[model samples]
Each structure stands twice: as structure tokens, then as C-alpha cells.
Target chain A: MREILRLIVVLSLICGISAGALTVARLNLASRIEKQSDFYVRGPALERLFGKPAEELLGNKISLPIGDHLYPIFYLTEGSEITELAVEAPGPGGYGGDIIVMIGLDLRENRMVGMEIIQHSETPGVGSRVEKASFRKQWQGLPVDEPVELTSQGGQIDAISGATYSSKAVVNGTNHIIDLIRRHRDDIMAVIKAKGE
Target chain B: MTLKQALVHGLWEDLPPFRLVLGLCPALAVTSSAENGLGMGLAATFVLVFSNMFISVLRKVIPDKVRIGSFIVVIATLVVLVEMIMKAYFFPLSQQLGIFIPLIVVNCIILGRAEAFASRNPVLLSMADGLSVGIGFTISLAVLGSIREILGAGTWFGWQVFGASFEPFEFMVKAPGAFICLGIILGLMNAYSRMRGETFIQT
Candidate 1:
């Protein structure tokens, strides 16, 4: 029918025009948005975990190949010398959904400088307690080579009250990423060294 | 409708999520904090105003049978554009808002106005309707968000209002909390309307 044809043409034109406009907008703003998200959303967590300000650390960010994805690895320097490495690891095996954690490593001290929950979908009151300082602070200065586990499973970490599953997810996720880092420790160090030049 | 009538209607008489009883999903989901509410509201307002205006301008050209489809495409495009821009420019706010930004396409308030108001109304009146409805939605979300944040977390806009000793009622920030808070507010609004003897949803 003529009516059907007209309807199709009108809808197609509207959709085509919209898609075209969006593509233009995206092309112009993609880089700025990526920079902003890093500075705003992930910046606070990184700043808290690292003693230095986020803006100072921004210059040292480098992407390292880890598994199938390019993971962002930030170098914490002291007067041109790379003193520490902060790796943004995927801890996707969360109770609710994927959990991303930012972990700092002190290469000289050979310990975990700190860890922060960058993004998570855990239950607000229960599982979401992972955002608390008390819970996350336990990882500071922890020996990176040793297995990270909850006290219930014969490990050192204490689980949040009434949130054992979510707590376990964080512990397991950290351990999983830690194991990968340990396996590829030399390559990680090499990448950091190359970026420092 | 007159510009004055259109603007006034969105503010009180046909306030979305309350009097209009529309767009309750975002109202409940994002009102856990004042910041989230404000962010969602402003974003929605941007989409509503632009979408309404676009719909109004193209109303005559759009065939009646496929008007819904055209309206949806326009809205969907705007939502995508907003989502990309937010992710690129306002990363923190975008992250805080999460999936709610993309979900705006389905929000009844935007599409509702496009169909009921923009499709039939003149351009200026449609624009006025868009602005007023948006302001109404924003105010309602803000009130809900502030109350929830204050009671649930003892904070407003992430700043501590209560002293260190004050214990927060954790229940007020959860899903049940959203329902309870919105329900009470809706009841109060209904009571206020009863007192004024003004019927809501007057066409």
C-alpha cells in the first residue's frame, strides 16, 4: 500500500538522519570523554590508593597487554624513577556483575601498596560494603606473591558482616589478577621500564 | 494550549511521576541520592525539550500510522547522542548514572509528550510543555533524592549533614526504601490535591 511505503520512507529518513548526527558527535567527543571519565570517575579511587595526586600520575599511564585486553597500567614515579605500578585489573567474577578494581603495587617494597573498588554492582547495603575504607584498607602493604583469601577459607582477609559471598568475590578476583600479575611479573616490569624512558 | 497554561501544567497539575503518574522507573531507580536524581532529571529534560521540538516541527509531514515509529527513532537517536556525550565529557556523572542514561529512550514522559502534546500542539506551546514537564520531573526527583540520601546515608549530595555519631537508617537507600519514600511522597501529594479540590490528569 502507498501508506505503508510512505511510513517506511519517513521512519527510515528519521533514523538515518539521527544516526548520522550521532556519529558526528561521537567522532568529535570520544577522546575528551575518555579522558574525563578517567580523571573524574577513576581518579578519586586512584588518588586515595596512591599518596600522590591523580593529575600528577596521569602522565605515567601506559596500556599493557594482559590476556585479550589492553589493561591500563599507571607508573608512580619519584623524581624520574618509577617507584611503583598501579594496574587496573578486571575482577569480573562479582556476585552481582562485573567488578573492576584498581590495585597499586610497590615494586621496591614488593607489596601491594593499596587497592580500591573502581566500579561494582554489588547490593547497596550488603555487598556494596566493599566500598568502605575499613574493608579495602586490609589489602595495603600485603605481600603480593602470597595467595589472597578470606579468613573463612584459611586466608588473612576478613569478610564484611552478612556479605560473605560478595566479600569472597573481591578476594577471589584480587587473587586471580594477582596470580596473573605474578606469572607475567617480568613482562609487566619491562613495560613499566620501557614507558619510563 | 497557551504558553502559560503549558508551563503551569507541567509544574503542578500534570507533574510527571506524581500527578501524571508517568516516568516512575527513573524516579525510583536513580533517586537514591540527590545528585543522581538531578543528573537523571537534567538529562531527561534535555531529551524531552529537543525531542518535543523536533516532533512538533515534523508533525505535519509524519503520517499518522507511522508517527509512533518516527517519534521513537527521533527519541532513540537523541538518547544515544546524549549517552555518548555523557560518557565522553561528564565521565564521573555518566558513571554514577550508569545504565539509566541509555534507558531514557523507554521513559514514558519523553514519548508521552511527543505523542500527546507535540504531535498536535503548536511549536511554542509544545516547547513550553516540554520545559514545564521537565522542571516538574526534576523538582520531584530532587526532593525524593535529597530525602533518601539524608535518611539513608545521613548525607546530602555526598556531604555529611549529620554528625559522626548519627546512625543512618540503611533501609532508606535500598530498593524497598525507594518504594517506601516515593509512596509516602505520592500519598502526601494526593492529600494536598484533595485539600485543593483540584483533579489531576485534567485534559
Candidate 2:
């Protein structure tokens, strides 16, 4: 009986120490880790879309109120002036869950620069094929005003051969972005203006 | 066993999945790609080394009846620590590894080592055991991963090893493929050991 008490005390002490140490490490490294993930994973994708270093894009980042949330917004600059907008438009529910994406738009609002899948839980081979350049290429230079949908549904985009649901999720996300852009156009412009001052 | 023997046994004789036939779950689950296999192996190695070291250090105080529970707590703590560190620093690899990192807590190699070696040995020897076993596991996973990735995806480490004309045998990356590949590897190892006139396990 005494042995059990001793064992419990010792084990509790060990657990307490381990948890305490982990708490300290978490507190110390949480922010730095977030920054690293943003730089490593999201950095390359954003760079590919904007043709600018991720660091440069990060400098102009500001979160703007859209609907109920403050969505991340980046003002892409040509030289000294903000010429385009890169908004993080997390789309509605996907085949797996919410498909988060970044959509870049030219200042003239004529064409979408590009779009990149930021985070997704789609299946590896079938649904995950949506991340391939072939599927995403169809979105580049596409007019924002044009309704985005799979070709089978009377739209320009081609749904991935075996991953129609996943493809539709991306298209749905694109439409969500379009809606956000249309509704928040004036507010986005004002946010840009405020940043310039 | 000598220090060198302790350090080297896991490389082949006591090697996991093939010889000891332990921790086969992750071996089959994550070996679809060379990258994932290596990631899972290294993560296991990290957990194994720390748990072995800590367990050895605390062996004297831990009661025999509650030792398994104690070992589990220590192992779980280390696993969580590894998960947090991996998520913070190596976020992409961490995501790729996903649940396997946490699953290291139950890896038979780790618990088996603590019960068999770490509890009886000094810290240095336990550390050596951990490193050797880890390297052995990593090597095994890497070979398995290479086989699967090459045949399944027609690629090596995501690079195209086979020409575009080559049709990949996609079955090599699926669940059945994992079973088939591990079975073949185990068979080959047994055959090779028999030919060498050496017992697969010392016992």
C-alpha cells in the first residue's frame, strides 16, 4: 500500500515536470513557429502566384473586415504604389472540409492573377489532384466577372477527372472569392487608401 | 552484450519490422513515399532516444509493479514534446507525418527497449541502443519507401526516376501494396539469413 502511494507521488512529479517544461517551450516558440510555417509553406505558394518574394508581400499585409471575419489582405505593389490585391478568401465547405485559398486580383479588376490552395484535407491522389498545376492553370488570367464553374456545369474550368467533388469545391471557393471581392470592392479600396497615408 | 554490439544489433539482427517484426503499422502506413517513410523513422528515432535516456535515468526510482505505467507516461511526454517541436519548427514534415508522430508512444520498439534494456542498463548504453535501433528503423523504412515510391509513383523522392512513358504500378502505394512489399522484404531477409547459416534472432 505504501509502495503504491510512493509510486503515485513519483509518477505525478514526473508528469508535472514534463508538462511544466513543455508549457515553457510552447510559450517561447509558439509565435516563431507560426512565422516559420507562414514563411516556408505559404511563402513559396504566394511567391509563385505574385512573382514577388514572400517577404515583400508580407510587408504590405493587413487584415480587413469581410462579412464577420477579418480576412487577411495583402496589397501587391509594382514599385512604390499598391497595384494589386491578394486576399485570403477561405471558401465554403469542401469535400473534406473548408478549402482555404489565396486569390490575387489585378487592380483593374479585369483578370485574376492566380489562385493557390493554402490548406486542404482532400484525399491524396484523387481529391488532392486539385493542387496540380493543370487544374489550377485554368484559373489564371480568368476574368473575375466570369462565373467560375466546371465545364460540365456550363463553366470554363475543367473538373479533375476522378475528383469532381474536390474540383467543384475549388470552383465554389472561387465563386465565394468573387462574391467577396464584389461586395467588398469599395471597402478594400478604402483600406488600400488608408495604408498609403 | 558489448557496447558496440548494443549499438549495432538493431541495424540488422534486432532490426524492427523485418526481424523483430515490431512496429509494423507505421512501416506499412507511411512508406508510400520515401519522404514520408524517412520522416516517420526519424521522428520515431527522436522519441526513442529521449525516452530511452530518461527511462534509464529514472529506472532506479520507478517501482516494478508500476513501471509500465511510468514508462508510458515518460514516453507519452516525449512524444508530445516531439509533436510540438515538429509542428513548430518542421511544420510541413510534421503535417506530412501527421498522426504517426504521436503514435510513436505505442511503438513496440520503444517500450520493448525500455523494459528490456533501459531498465537494466546505464544511460550511455541505453542512448546507444536508441540511436542504433532508430538508424535501423530509418534504413528499413527508407528501403521500403524507395521500393514503393519507385514502383508505385515512378518517382524517387518525388523526382521522376522512370521516364514519362513508364506506367506506374499504383498498387505499390496502396494498403495492399504495403502488406505485399513488407511481406516480400521479410521473406527475402529470412531467406538470406538461412543461407548465411545464422539464426534471425539470437534466441
| Per-candidate interface DockQ score | 0.51, 0.35
Runs of candidate 2 exceeding 4 Å displacement: A44-56, A63-197, B87-91, B200-203
Could you tell me which 10 consecutive residues in candidate 1 chain B have the lowest summed lDDT? B194-203
Put down candidate 1 lDDT per residue, B8-36, tens digits, no spaces: 98988888888888999999999989999
> What's the count of clashing pairs in each model shown?
1, 0
Q: Could you give the C-alpha RMSD of every candidate to the true structure, in order shown?
A: 4.7, 5.5
TM-scores, all candidates, are 0.74, 0.70
Instruction: Give the per-prediction TM-score of chain B.
Output: 0.96, 0.97
C-alpha lDDT of residue B51 in model 2 = 90
TM-score for the B chain of model 2: 0.97
Model 2 TM-score on chain A: 0.79
lDDT string for model 1 (A1-197, tens) is 98889888888888888889988998998788768868875677678878678888877788877668877777777776667877776675577876777788887888998888877777766888998999999999899888788898899899998888778777876876688678887787687778667
How well is each residue in B61-105 modelled by candidate 2, as lDDT tens digits?
988878998899899988888888887878888878766777889
